[model samples]
Target: MKDTSTGASSGEAVREGPDTFKRTALLALGALGIVYGDIGTSPLYALRECFTGPHGIAPTPQNVLGVLSLIFWTLLIIVSVKYLIFVMRADNRGEGGILALMALAMQRQRGQSTPVARPVLITLGIFGAALLYGDGLITPAITVLSAVEGLSVATPVFEPFIVPITLAILTVLFVVQRHGTARIGSLFGPVMCVWFFTLAALGVKELVHNPAVLSALSPVHGVMLLVHNGWHGFLVLGGVFLVVTGCEALYADMGHFGWKPIRWAWFSVVLPSLMLNYLGQGALLLRDASAARNPFYLLAPSWMLYPLVALSAVAGVIASQALISGAFSLTRQAMQLGYSPRMEVVHTSAEEMGQIYLPGINWALMVGVFTLVVTFRSSSALASAYGIAVSTTMVITSIMAYVVARERWGVSRALAIPVAGLFLTVELSLFSANAMKLADGGWFPLLLAVVIFTLMTTWKRGRAILAAKLRASSIPLKELLGSFGDHPPLRVSGTAIFMTGNAEGTPPALLHNLKHNKVLHEQVVLLTILSEDVPHVPGAERVVVEPLEQGFVRVVATYGFMENPSIPDVLKRCREKGLQFQLMGTSFFLGRETLIPTKRPGMAVWREALFSWMSRNARSATAYFRIPPNRVVELGSQVEL
Candidate 1:
């Protein structure tokens, strides 16, 4: 059975039915709202940047055909073949992306025994996760700057205000995110869908004007460019990286939409239109490369120009919105998987699944984007920072896919290695090419990622160090239970469930409870929530209870990284299992610790203070976990680092 709430399978089997089909189509369209928003809008700026930017260098006639050919084949190989035909099939129990694929592959390797436990697999997964953060930060800045600069294209009078105007626009966009995209998403798919078709229509008219542009489709042109132009051809790889910017979203949002709907949207809708539009732009540019300064808008007729500008602007906003939302989802996934600090997540709709907002991710991106807009005012300036992050991500994804192909799907050795090698070669070239831009504004995102990565690594290590310190000299639970003997119970009556982060390990607050009260509550439930990357689990797989005499009951609630566990709802299910519990006085105990600064080798004291400050102001567990305020108890602890 498949679940409607989260749209994930209820069993280990990857199940999809009539209803799943319907919602997946709807949400995939929703995901399409997000997925195609960035790359779909890329046609707006890609050609302009390719010609006007320093490396693009005015695009000579000899290179123009080859450039067009590279764009064509790049999209064909990366998006058409790799993503649509191949990578999407590697979904894990209807879930997708590098992490989901890794989880599935790891699980399969250890099936009926133990799962794979290789360090390289885990590290590759982390690298993919890291690249996403870098990509997310750059997407908003570049997208918004590209659109806002269209003002200058309309009238040079708007140039002076571009930065301030762009910053203000982005600030407003980030501010409005809490209201949820679900309500506004109705416009997203239709606008982007229309945007592509309209561009396609325009492209068709232009291509009909000059049929020679279609010859650029051959790879020979791209290869010839490499032979003739020397390594300068590699510079276009950075721009080509922009062409498939939203490809990751295709796989990441797969859980919301099944492979079929996405594939349908990609081929029948997105692909044809994008190709026609790119070819049309190429044709237009072939006539006058200077027109490449604005191929997308130039393709439009004079009468339709303003409307095209307006539509393009709206689509640009939507494109950024989709990537912004994707960042939120990925952050939540990261937190659930133990790599990020706990952040507040708000559910956007009652019926719709995976509609969420993370305050921390929301603000971080807003600030980062605004700063980028101020620093690098043009799309081309910000473009240097764009493709490196995404290409690195794609390369990491290809590596993860290789592991999955062999270990999980039982794919043949002959097929898997070569296919992986082909993508790796292509992606490696693109990544290296983009990497060459680090001297330009490319350091912006990389610097941001390194800061984030440091925080993530520090938090992880600090946690491990604390855990090891606590574990090394801690009293055994079995011995302690025997000694304590549930000592003089009678605190709260029925099922006072305490949510603990540590499951098999000793929970710090539990010791505090033992030391202070010296008495246990009746039917004490020590609950721990576990989140896995592969979305959703069956009800039968939900509860893992080990009942102890004298009022102790340990409960574990498992959730998908994409899903949030509602405590009240989980408790209701427990009640249905005949573990009757009262809601009003059930009392949810939560732990809140303040990290004190330490002279750790990882980060400077200022960064440590920033993390501590962030921890202090973070949303409380009562609000975050959706616990009733009056019924919640928070225990605070001081940390050395």
Candidate 2:
């Protein structure tokens, strides 16, 4: 029997201690590699796009300062103030993300003295999560394309091969994902450490020559340009929005590195480096307007251009890797919470539970990424589609954050409303600027988000209806036990374990087994596994066992959304509670349902069909839960939707 009091498992790493300067500084270093990669790489294209792309303005002195000021303020306000200060405080037990925050809001709202409508809050959260998918797809495509576009600036000869080289690099990056990042992840911090220093150095070199460009730091220049340039300056916001593109990753990665590390890294290193780089680009444009065509690359001397471009490509790959890993994590969380279908989740590292590979998501993202590269071809073209998904997601997050502030933080409605209002006002304006390019490449992400939202909502609703039907037809556990007293079958020798989705009623698999076998095992165990909303649940609270009459036992095993449940492992833990288990003597029974869709009032026929297909294709419970194949038996049943 295993001891239930041992809360920490050998397979995982747990950090425990009060906050200290050393720990915070180390975590902050790790945060730079994983959390800041995407936004860090934005300098390769963000500034150039503002002065050269379709929505660009001339690189005059006033215009250059105006754009630089907007980029600086956007980063300071959106990434620093809104997310770092406000959203990070709303972590779900040390985890922060759109889904984690959503779960936190929903959990607290239910227990509030006066609650808001829960459905509206949930819908807002779901939409925000859906938009992240679009962001994930676009981040890789644009980041890589922008990095390689630097080749054209170095010389026109490398221009024709730019697309092919990018394709090859992305192909290799995605292909190596199954091997896990445990080894390479260490190198990320040091490499990014060097990269940030280079950015600051390059900017400082230019700032010394044109110290007057420092005036762009003031808000008055940004406001003057917008008012004087009219609609042209407003449209340039679509490009300025790119500077803070990867801010979401910082929040999403809070679970891996605590908020303090991420906050420290941003303020200490990332913010300073980015400000210097943007100001340098502006200074370059003031002296030579032609440099606006590729101001970031132009900041480097001819001798350093090649090395800098090489460094940027590596940074781009690291950024893409972080986003890809995030996609896998989000998908797993969605599945556990019943917002997505079950898929094969492969744990790539024995030491790290968070390192996982999903074949389905891997290939799907590749297809979308390849299509975007082929369709958009250039970084400037791809930039047209970049910000809207993130902008919309930010707006939704602020709305959800308002609820968290009022209910969870005990903030007054008067203060919370205005804070949320200010956030929305900024995000919506950015979204509106990006919306102007809808006909241009912007439609791709919006369309993709809509499709995904439909599929997720349909699957969730379908499962609810199916569970209700199953519960309605299930026999009470007391009735089943009473029937055995009246007419008991022949007693078998070994133990029988029946897996069920519901705990309060008799399992369909057990009923089918009894009907066909005409015998009962000496020991029977009915088990139900549940996935909770939190990221991790301690092992001490993992299992609940109840002994019933006639040698029957009911077991409920609970796992958190971030966990991967294993049946045999969980059953091994149950032995400490006086439940004996021998793998050779135990027989496991599982039910497999075949759905037949009809024109049901619960769902449209088309949606029912889609859900049925997804259900049929979902990974089997036996394989997913790591049950021994030799000891398993399957029973089939039909379900109508």
Best lDDT goes to which candidate? 2
lDDT, candidate 2, residue 49? 89
Candidate 2, poorest ten consecutive residues by summed lDDT: 1-10
Give one clash count per candidate, in the order shown. 2, 0
lDDT of 1 by residue, 177-234 (tens): 8887666767677677788779789899999988898888888888988788677777
* Model 1 regions more than 4 Å off: 1-32, 109-117, 484-495, 504-507, 591-618, 636-641
Model 2 agreement with the true structure over 157-261: per-residue lDDT tens digits: 999998899889899988988887877877787788888999999999899999999999999988988998999999999999999888778777777776777
**RMSD, one per candidate, in order:** 3.8, 3.7
- At residue 572, give the lDDT of candidate 2: 80
Q: What are the Cα lDDT values of the candidates?
A: 0.73, 0.85
TM-score for all predictions?
0.90, 0.96
